[model samples]
Target: MNFLNLEIYLDYIKDNGYRCTPQRSSILSYFIGQKNRFVTAKSVTDHLQNKMGNVSSDTVYRNLHLFKDIGIIDLTFQDGESLFHLKNEINTHEYKFICTECGNTTDLNLCPMEKMDTALNDYLIYDHKFEVYGVCPSCL
Candidate 1:
């Protein structure tokens, strides 16, 4: 993945009025440099502990909240726990599939549900909750 995109996200938050601190930048770099989306605060802390020395869970939570506040990322309570991922990286709604057995996520490229976005906006007047679960290739 291109770390430059993460930098863009940082610039985005700044453009929206938030200061990008070193710890926050490290956390964002960890997220962007890593391949997994199904990650937790503990994992982030562990990853940062190696190079950046140590960081508290509070710092992780606070920075995550800041990312969420700017809409560059989003959090969800799925399967039984919290999950976070960049909004723009959230493949199309139809492409979001989660594997319950392995917790792996796959992004499909087909555009079959392109119309659903508008339909949901028209009927719900905002948007509708849409998520799907299935076994991923690795799990299956």
Candidate 2:
């Protein structure tokens, strides 16, 4: 689901049993403005404080996790810090090669799980995340 619209996002939150608080709306708006780029939680908290006045980092972190849990955002770790971006599509599965040097990401067309079906025959997999980490050619 594309939540670029604040109203659509707020409605989603309400539909999912969450309150449409101003802080949550502002957070989603910030991510919407960022498009698909990943951003640090500190940056999100700073934006909230500057835009909404006296917002707490703890509150921001809590909501960020909540958003991720509900699949509104995607999360990754870069240099020991958590980074997040709004998920463009809810049901699409994507694998990516991530650059450790610049935090850049490139989508991979192949799904590794396709080759592991035999090994996973006894397992019931509901979901998975796949990422390859290395320096991009530009950084290399």
Query: Highest TM-score, which number?
Result: 2
Candidate 1 lDDT tens digits, 65-93: 77776666556676576766655442223
TM-score of 2: 0.81
Candidate 2's residue-wise lDDT over 1-140, tens digit each? 34467777677778889998989988998988875567899999999999999999999999999988877777888778898877666435667777777766677779888878888899999877787889999999
Top-lDDT structure, candidate number: 2
Instruction: Candidate 1: give the clashing pairs.
Output: none
> What value of lDDT does candidate 2 attain over all alpha carbons?
0.81
lDDT comparing candidate 1 with the true structure: 0.65
| Reference-based lDDT, residue 63, model 2 | 97
Off-target runs (Cα >4 Å) in candidate 2 are 1-3, 101-104, 135-140
